[model samples]
Target: MRKPVLTIFYQFNPWHSTIGGVQTVVSNFIKYAPDEFEVRLVGTSNDPAQPNGKWQEAELAGRKLQFMPLFTLQNDNFRSLVPTTLKYTAALIGHCFASDFMHFHRLEPSLATLHWSGDKTLFIHNDIQKQMQSQENANAILWRRFPQAYFQLESLLVKQFNQILSCNSESVKLYQQKYPTIADRVAFIKNTVDSQTFCPLSLEEQQEKRVALTQKLELPANTQFILFAGRLHPQKDPLLLVRAISALTDLNVHLLIAGDGELATDVRLEVERLGLSKRITMLGSVIQAELTKLHQATNVFVLSSAYEGLPLVVLEALACGTPVVTTNCGEISKLLPANCGVICEERTPVAVADALRQVLLHAENYPIEACVRATEPYSASTVVGAVYSDMWHRWKQQNLVSTVQKCSTNFT
Candidate 1:
């Protein structure tokens, strides 16, 4: 039997060397994709050579990844928009002509998928337009930078995919509402964690790791550590975290933000102006091991994202048996079981601070075991299995449909 072909496309810049949720998602997919399927990953980033050509291909584990470098000219505003779109669209059309089925992973590729007539599946990680606009306050100014024609082109291209897979129910509902014609095609598949890498650490292990981490960072034990781990983008609302820390005067809570982005300097200034210089530590970026240790050490894990499909950090914190304080954005409320974590009010510093205090002070109310158990369904194997199953089922259905049509034509 011919192996079902899977093609994943995205814009990934690993050289920046910072860990974020999208990076985790792609890495996890690459990590867990089954051997039975023939996988091809195509993506672009800051790769300089052969800017308009397919740079190279590599075998990661058992899967194949093709990294194509899209050339962008300096001072050319329509490079990623028109040129990248045309190149990726050509690539997808070529893949469609060769492959039995296609699993797309980004808006850029989705545009191409729409143009190519094939068995297509799209994985929705976030509301891309909302996410783009979120960086409006930051230097991105995505809308201002990208021409209005780009949105029209993207919207036009998105309508062509045969199936859509979203990471959360909220995304599904929102997209269904936004694009009612494709409501039936939208499917729900949640993100997963690698249980082997994210399993429960022993009490002794937790204590030892936490102590070592705090010692390395020189943070005091008495200080309430509020951990925020992700890119310091405007969407993440890093300033709100600093503002929340500034609000708490009664407690010796010290905030540790473990990530980097465009707003890092602005956030640091906010921390200083609030007189929280001593209480805040911007660890910039840390490795996965250190992040796990920080999770184990932290009293509260907070995410202040303006929006999210479903955050991996929240799942990671739960796996570490740490309580979380996050906004209602993302599928957070659904992820937060009866005793998992605290859901903060929408986008307000006072509300987030108040929610943080509640979780920190009443930490006992949140059962650590339950939260850990809640994350089991999101294990990498489980989640990847879901993705594989859906793609396989769709591929079979498309084949059956084609066979039936062929038989009908023969009879006629």
Candidate 2:
């Protein structure tokens, strides 16, 4: 028999949304969910044009999707916290009633709601409180609303869930470290990728595309190509990448940074200041297909982010058989095996540039098989299966029947 359906509720900010790891995981689950499970998406709207409304179901990527436009408080400042959170809480209340199983990505509605009913599964990507606690005072208010309310609320919500899914072992450990009593509740399932669609391009194809890209971007033939794809934000630290490139004077390398954000202008300014305009090509916001081409064309893929929760780009780059240069963040050690990439000790321009030069100079010495194999367990189907397995195991332990009607629901 097919397992019962599970409804995932999230307030998706679509317009500013990039195809990052979390979104990719959700999409991948929808694509290859178990036969016994019916996946329903309930996303909150970010449309300023239409704010006051309830959640509605629709089709996203040919899957059943539900989007709700709730009254949201736009600014992260103090005044809007309570009202905006209440709005989100109301939407979640509606979602809770509709869903057989509720999986929450964000803390807003979950924190606000009094009742924690049904087979609940909480997905905590990062320690939001821990992250916020470290931030400046201005940002701290956005982190904790109803500080007194949350005092008991977090404990209540944590106990209410049948299981809690974390992105990596590191995250799981963090949760265990904080809440040792609920150690059994926390589980780890790393993010996945679409292997068939995201696999490496042929050498000839890569070279051909590289030639076209070189001509289109006016890139020099002698210059070694290095790719940095992601948002140009403080979180991403793209300017640091420019500074890194600037420091790499000995190497004839050209950096192709793809993506734009709040730090876009700042990154450009840094490029100018360092006189790295010739060495760096800021190809702002290229689509996925083009991104694949860029990954294939590049000698090494680099991620210089200050922090991350298992970035999908790193996986994508590996799937494309491209070597990587990244800062030691999150579970990157688990992701990058052997010679697939180099992990820097710190997030500095000098550190990044030194790693970049080394990787580019002897890129071929890295294990190609290791690079490709690193992404094997993280394919869309494999990842989706793992998620179902974890959920099913939890359901079985709790002696609950899967409501969906597919017979191939066994975790094995």
Top TM-score model: 1
Q: What TM-score does structure 1 among the candidates reach?
A: 0.83
For residue 318, what is the lDDT in candidate 2?
A: 93
lDDT of 2 at 249: 88
lDDT of prediction 2:
0.70
Root-mean-square deviation (CA) per prediction: 4.4, 5.7
- Largest lDDT belongs to which candidate? 1
Local distance difference test values of all predictions, in order:
0.72, 0.70
- The TM-score of candidate 2 is 0.82
User: Which regions of candidate 1 fall more than 4 Å away from where they truly are?
Assistant: 13-18, 45-98, 127-141, 144-151, 397-412
Candidate 2: C-alpha RMSD after superposition: 5.7
List, residue by residue over 1-412, the lDDT tens digit for candidate 2: 3456677665544333453456556667676766566666655454567654555655545656555545543322123334444556666554344455677776566654447456777776653444434332233244344456654566666766767787656668866776888889888877777886577777788778777877877877666789988766555677778888888989878889888755677788888888888888888777777787788778899998666667788998998889999988767887887689889998788999888888888877665566788899878787778778876776675444333323346532
Which lDDT tens digits does candidate 1 get at residues 44-158?
A: 4453443544546665545565545344223211123444445555655544433555666666656545555557767777755466556436344444366576667756865
For candidate 1, the per-residue lDDT at 292 reads: 83
The residue ranges of model 2 lying beyond 4 angstroms of the native Cα positions read: 1-3, 13-19, 45-98, 112-116, 127-141, 144-153, 390-412
